[model samples]
Target: MHIRRICESEGDAAGTLWDHMCRETGDGRPLTERARRDVSRMLAASAWHRDAFCLVAVHPGGRLAGFVNGRISTGDGLLPGLLGEIEALYVVPGDRGQGAGRALARAATDWLVAQGARTVRYLSCAGAHDDHRFWRSLGFEADMVCLSLYREP
Candidate 1:
């Protein structure tokens, strides 16, 4: 598979993949209309953000197999230096384990390092053992944990 930045014409494909990812992660049966719109806005804004980018892994036959979105920014007040974040990463079920995810991640992290990032981070669902392993294989170590509580209306 070949990896490269996503093109303007491929927005819908990327959005579809994003929706799939959301569902797989248990976000919604089908993403709410507002959620879909939010994702579209984020993807559209990526092209204009110099510090952010979205990359796609394409099959030899020209089908998109996966995508990763990354960005570089100043760390929150407690931390120093620039930070690189892997905002979203997903590989089509059939394409997992074939290195598309790795290639996309490597490219995004490399770009962030080139832009002077001092650290790279990705947030996986707390209980996602497989996802955790995939990132660990890439040299990422857990440095933080986030706890959340939900309240019914």
Candidate 2:
């Protein structure tokens, strides 16, 4: 298996992967009406591309097995100058246990660290739902918990 960072040339592939991730999510909210406006604004963004990163894992036959996306920021002061937080991660069911997820994660985290991130945070909400064991096996420990309070508009 091979893992690598995504580039502009792979926009379609990345978009497809993102679509798959969204579809796999149980969340019911559709894309927001404001998303178009957000995209217009994001088109003018320079740091968005620089701060954001993605890693993709390919199977032996060159099929995309999984991917990870995240950004390195100053939030939480976990690392040094930048803290890496994983925003999304997904692996096809058939690809599980083959190290695709791990390879993707390692690539993303390595890039963040190379960019001077002192801390890496993997946001596993709902207390690790299904892959807690996988993360624990990777040597990650929970140092803090985030609680959310939402109000219906």
**Best-fitting candidate, measured by TM-score?**
1
Per-candidate TM-scores read 0.89, 0.75
Q: Distance (Å) between predicted and true CA of 118, model 2?
A: 1.2
lDDT of 1 at 35: 78
Candidate 2 Cα errors over 4 Å, as ranges: 28-48, 60-62, 76-80
Whole-model lDDT per candidate:
0.84, 0.67
Give the range where candidate 1 is weakest over 10 consecutive residues by summed lDDT. 40-49
Tens digit of per-residue lDDT, candidate 2, span 40-72: 233223124788776767767767777777787
Candidate 1 matches the true fold with a TM-score of 0.89
Worst 10 residues of 2 by lDDT: 39-48
- Writing each residue's lDDT as its tens digit, candidate 1 over 24-132 gives 8755566787877777667656766798888889988878898899889997845678999999998999998788889988988887888888899999889889889
Report the error of model 1 at residue 125, Å.
Answer: 1.6
